[model samples]
Target chain A: MLQWRNSLARHATRQSVSVLFTSVGRRVELMRAFREAYETLGLDGKIVGVDIDPLAPALQVVDHPYIVPRLNSPEFIPTLVEICRQEKITLVFPLIDPDIPILAANRTILEETGARVVVISSNAVALTADKWLTNQFFERLGLPTPRSWLPAQCDPDEIDYPVFIKPRRGSAAKSTFRVSDPEELRFFSRYVPDPIIQEYLSGPEITNDVICDLEGEVLSVVSRQRIEVRWGEVAKGVTIYNPDIIDACVQIARALPAVGPITVQCMMKDDVPHFTEINARLGGGLPLGIAAGVDSPKWLLAKAAGIAVDIPPLGSYQRDLYLTRFDESFFLTKDDRAQMASRCL
Target chain B: MLQWRNSLARHATRQSVSVLFTSVGRRVELMRAFREAYETLGLDGKIVGVDIDPLAPALQVVDHPYIVPRLNSPEFIPTLVEICRQEKITLVFPLIDPDIPILAANRTILEETGARVVVISSNAVALTADKWLTNQFFERLGLPTPRSWLPAQCDPDEIDYPVFIKPRRGSAAKSTFRVSDPEELRFFSRYVPDPIIQEYLSGPEITNDVICDLEGEVLSVVSRQRIEVRWGEVAKGVTIYNPDIIDACVQIARALPAVGPITVQCMMKDDVPHFTEINARLGGGLPLGIAAGVDSPKWLLAKAAGIAVDIPPLGSYQRDLYLTRFDESFFLTKDDRAQMASRCL
Candidate 1:
């Protein structure tokens, strides 16, 4: 046991060498941030991607890549465990929320195979993974949130008109719809078995990604106000920091130590923080967190491995950092428009 | 969706078929009682046996037998899920407590695959599966319980002399030990990382197995007091009903709707019930429960499959139910023993 402890300690002191064991359907932005975190940690290890999708961009820079089925498939976790065991993986991280519970359940078994499973506690993961549950937990903690109820539980006669119905377990504006009254609620409730009826909080939506240890100690915190989302993924965002919201995020984090990497999303209306939901894994604006001196991926990996995390000094980076996807449509030439029109014709 | 629901309803009503999923672990008795409950319900599904040991007696009645690895192993749940899916299993009952959490976690996925996963909610599962957590939850509800602390948090100064130390997550008294002082606690705590230290309550150790519906309504409640345990398995037990302890058991059942087919153990002393631990699955005296008339296994499976549970009326069955297992040593005949002794000589 002493020798094992000594070996672990020695491994921790060396430069950060990281591996990302992932599958298909991962958000591109978060994957990029993992690479940035590797750079931030001043480690020699590069991002290693594993996905069955041959076209996934993650395969481009990955030091090693393995083609595997989608993470939701039955073979995904067992295959990953086998790879981690054979490869002597130091840390196995999961990008998907559904995968979080499954991975956390295998912590001890994976650790026996010499791979540290760094996922949030199942309690924290469940509470944060489901958007409706996230709102309920925050309300219980006396945190501000948009008025929300399950469509089946809500009576339009009892509430204000013009409520919004959103998927109970998704991110961004995926499957979000505005409901005017009882008819719409009835129609949608039958269509969507699980959805939240939330009183629309009119304001720009912003998300704060806070990384904390199991004991609820915040290692680094960063926030980004979302400007646009096109297909359930963030299109653009601007980074900002609010101390009050950050403190609330810390409290929520402390309440859920099993939540390793999380994002507390809230809407700001007239300087009031109205939390909408929480994500148990990396949020869309993770790159912004990385740019703002929050090396979340490295800290998370280190923490899961039971290694001490030395977060880069907070003063080392700026807070106004931001990122945006550069679509070719933004700088289309006349020739491109002519070609597009010709194709349409 | 409408057609699917209609077909499900039709399938449930047209079949009085009974199917049994049995494990050779500690909950074998619980499995038997559940079978009796099905008989009372007029469900036709026959019980099936599953264990790595093919010689398990449950195979005597079950038409289909499956051999699998240990229930606590990581491969157990996934393998069971695969089998259930392929077989179009209506109700996949888990007789073991540790299997409760994993089953509950993947319930949605299992249900989607045409098998109804029956287990309590994750929160309730954790509370009942962990002895220390169950004690704390009961105490908060003002239920009677002996003093207890998690071994990691136990201090010699805090515990009374002659306390009981039990592993937080094991069953059948495999990891239970009687310890008197700090020296013993130190020695035992070294083996198990998170044992629960409890004030030794001297009384008849009684267990009440209750089957409840999703609405927290009791279908049947069978009581048993432990007679003896050898090599960490119940060797002998007899069923008896105590109105005093039964009342407390009812309260506990109502406290968690997620809890179904639960066996709660307590100490009956001075005509008072002192709660000890909760097993979310069937208990060891399940066969006794079946013999006494409240067949739990069948009823639990029926309810899990969304079939109506025909709970037998109270006092409909006799008490004094008994169950016993012979030790392997008892299997040797007199001639075999003599031959063995001669060989030794």
Candidate 2:
């Protein structure tokens, strides 16, 4: 039965493109966006959502939902490959930070099953994952970044009292602190693992959604100033057409050579975009970008299906578009849990 | 024209209830719930939403959205009183934390405008708002509470490592940290303003929605175990009917004499609910409680309209009802912003 299904999916690839989303945790909007894209483009495809947890919200909305092992587990890659092979997945997108490097590192192996993993290069991931290296990369690219230092290399006396200290390899603002004095700086430096201390950028933050084609050519850049942030995600944001921010994002995309969607974050210092870090996956606030007329999901879907989509020039999207978000729920029952668990790989 | 409209609203009060939600920042779901309740009950009343910011998301959905002064501003209470008188608002609900005490303190003044402020007594708000005082209150009520100490009262050597430190008066999990050692605790105690130190309850958290009538009668209690939390709000949760938790919540309501909806949060340690602080307003995750069949919005609206609502007895909500949430956006343009600003008081 599995062989027959796989053959059927293979035959359907000419008119359709099946996509897979890894670590599809709470990304129900992204799943819905892709579904809408498929409908709009008149393409037939299956969206397979995989996560370690069966109760993942995004998994409930996809065409196919499968439970996979944790990212660190040895069987994870193999399970993904089998799913791709079975579902005839033409494109794969990693939705979270940790999944990106893992998928990028195993890109060749994943693509051997005829699935194009949508990720940046492993080198780019390495440069972006570590906060210290990201600062260095920003300096190397002539992009202004917040002045950062290693704990041992910096003198407390010389450093500003209200500096920022965070883990060198952390996401979602975890274990981050705003050190007010020398005492806090010393305490948090030891508290956080592999800490990177940086001068606090006390300015409005800008998050840019930089979309690129499969060949790493920049397609569109949509910059949104974060009005409010919750749990490291933009809760309230407004899109702005700032030339400098757009240019900085375009420059970063060109330098890093990102594929698909990458989110570039920066803090404005004296009206200049001081680039912070690049997330190699689609951002949480990508919905706002799409709403502002970039239509990245549609563009990506069109590209994956080998259709010629009208590509707008960079920075051509809408400006002053505001976004305010609220949580919507999916109600599940015990019976649904049982059915979901039965589909585990 | 205003007097005529007020008279019309007064006439409509027999079959409808005009609610005023103060500081309606991001309670879009709550707004929608009240709207749904109005529709379900076949009522005809306007929902007036007030906020200091014109860009608040919840303001977009209400029948009448008015931008009010900041809570700390001198004009805030008078403006609200004027709005309540002009709009003929029958019931007033405060959405955010800071709005609660202000509304409670001015309840009589607001009620003189013929609006019933849905808030607890000022004493209850005072006890709930201060974490240190809440700990003492819990102990007095014979409830299990985490060992907490004021900054000047506690010894660092006597405290356990990995204890929690936070502002005595804080919300949204702001400025809270887990102190791993003596030095960090000492540093953070001074760092956080008016800090309280408590034993960190290393267990799953459960947020209970305890609904009460205007007479301070316990209507129903719905307890949900928080499977995941983001920005101090439940991202994923499952409704559970733990009788102990329900009893504890009932005990709390009885002791504190709560009015309307109050949220009781606790952490389970060794299978016992160690009560944490209380929020005198509706919980952020009240949607889950409504979905679980408590239907607090409908109940509140019906009660305000003098319509008979069939609220189930305590501990009668659905068990194992799961909720998983994602953000949905409201895309607004510059014109919308101008119009919203024009509605300011």
Candidate 3:
């Protein structure tokens, strides 16, 4: 019976190829781009999209869609792997950061069925997942990071007053506040469940999408700084070049030997880049980077399929790219305003 | 805002009480009895049944039901806790053995919402979950237990032939196999996955439902030998009085300062009771024991609620009280038959 099952599986695998794609919230544009890429590649395979929301538009575009419990959860990785097993998935493309960590941890488990896994290692994912910890890592490595600390865990007597508090593991700026007093510190901890007390670095935040090879060699790097944020997301963002930020991105990318298609986020302060965090998957601003001539998805897929990835020429690519979307914005309380102003922005 | 939320929570807690009850598989009798007991006590609280199966009968009887994932699984516990937080669950009742360990570990997290967790500690739960480990624990404490060892891990020169390979974490002869050669061991591992190769004792198996207090002081212990197992579960059984078994149960209860019902299974051979495993929650034969004037659940809850559980005199309790149920008999392959004699009658 076991032999029969094995032979049937082998026959099926030889007949068709399968790819698993995991997403959190809405990622219609990313999924559409993926479909376009696969079609252009002329691969005879199926793309399966997994999301907690059954009604997500990305699901509609995929060949096979499975509604898992939630994507912003630890279960996403295991649940997607289970789906992969049932569907005989050949490749996995993580569309979100949380899935990266889980996929990396259980890569062997997913690959047991002769399906190869394409995920950043758990160590790489862990180093980049927590914004505050990522910044600390950069500082420890002398790679330039904004001064950050937990006000609740910090000594007020020695450090500067008025810091920024943002929820550590979140996309967009939710529950982000500015505080200048012990009273505010108390309130901030009470308000934000997992707040990161950061030394608000001066200047704007820039997001750089970089695709690297298996040996930590950078193939392409494109940057975007948030010019406008509405309802905790980059509602309007423009692609720009900062030499320091680009250098830092290359340095960070070169440090991760097994990671692919990671996004480096930082703030440029006085012509110096202060790293904030790294996302181990495609960033939301991927289209801007792709339009700027990075072709990160193609490069990422090549590495995932076990094909050798050639580092693209480091010549100047298209810049001055921008993306705009409508979002709701609310008032920052009086304390919130002071906290925001203190972040040296 | 925190104070207001706290006040609102307090108000709700005062207004109505709701307890969470998580049960495994399709056991409705236990859940119904719990509901009846709570309603009789004028607690005005509802039993919330959680199971992976959508068709679980417990769901029909509970005031609120969650047909979620497995309780021990990574996804299930967090989802269960999230539901508890959203519903303001006050008390958590772990009716399943596997869920006991997880629930016990997260007791502090559950109790953070001004709720009470009535569970044994994680250490106790872990100590009793695995059969081989439980027996080893008994042997370590100088208590009587069946001589057993995994032939594969055992010293080759010391191992006896015709050894029984039992599922390391399960019973009722389902994955059980007997092997006398390397070929048989290879064949058995294919089916059992990780069977414990043990020197199967020639004796009948018996189960004892021992109810203990918070400090591990025994209130009552009832013994029942297995007459039959339907689909790897206790379906037909006969009550018996074995003082040695009773002493072992008391010693185990005393070793672990558990605060709830515990069921200990043993095999009696040569007038000696061999410890198999200890169950943190009530057993399947508890209803029959209750019929025989045990009232285990009432005694347990009373003790947990700070009431005394004084077991009535054993004057009315009679030994050799046999009970039988008609269920589909399991079909054992030839290998299974060699491992376990068909004791169905």
Best by DockQ: 2
Tens digits of per-residue lDDT for model 1, A186-291: 6556545477788877768878777765455677667777755545445456667677887788778777663456777788878988988776666655766665
lDDT of 3 by residue, B216-248 (tens): 667778887776554445645666887777777
Better of 1 and 3 by lDDT: 3
Order of models, best lDDT first: 2, 3, 1
DockQ of 3: 0.01
In the range A1-345, model 2's lDDT, one tens digit per residue, is 999997677556536789999988988888898899998887888999998877788889999999999999999999999999999999999988999889999999999999999999999999999999999989998989999999899888787778999999999888888888787788788889999998898879999999987888888999999999888888889999888888888888988988888999999888888988899988989999989898988999888777678988878888898888878787788777778867876
Q: Highest TM-score, which number? A: 2
For all candidates, state DockQ relative to the true structure.
0.00, 0.70, 0.01
Q: List ranges where model 2 is wrong by over 4 Å.
A: A1-14, B1-13
Q: Please write out the lDDT profile of model 1 over residues B221-306, one tens digit for every residue.
A: 77776765444434446667677777777888888654557777888767788998777765655665665667566555566556
Q: What is the TM-score of each candidate against the true structure?
A: 0.43, 0.95, 0.43
lDDT of 1 at B8: 78
**Which residues of candidate 1, in runs, are more than 4 Å off?**
A1-12, A24-46, A214-216, A298-317, A327-345, B1-345
User: What would the per-residue lDDT of candidate 2 be over residues B29-74, giving only the tens digit for each residue?
Assistant: 8999999999887777999999877888899999999998889999
Give stretches of model 3 more than 4 Å off: A1-17, A71-79, A303-311, A326-345, B1-345
Candidate 3's displacement at residue B303, Å, is: 76
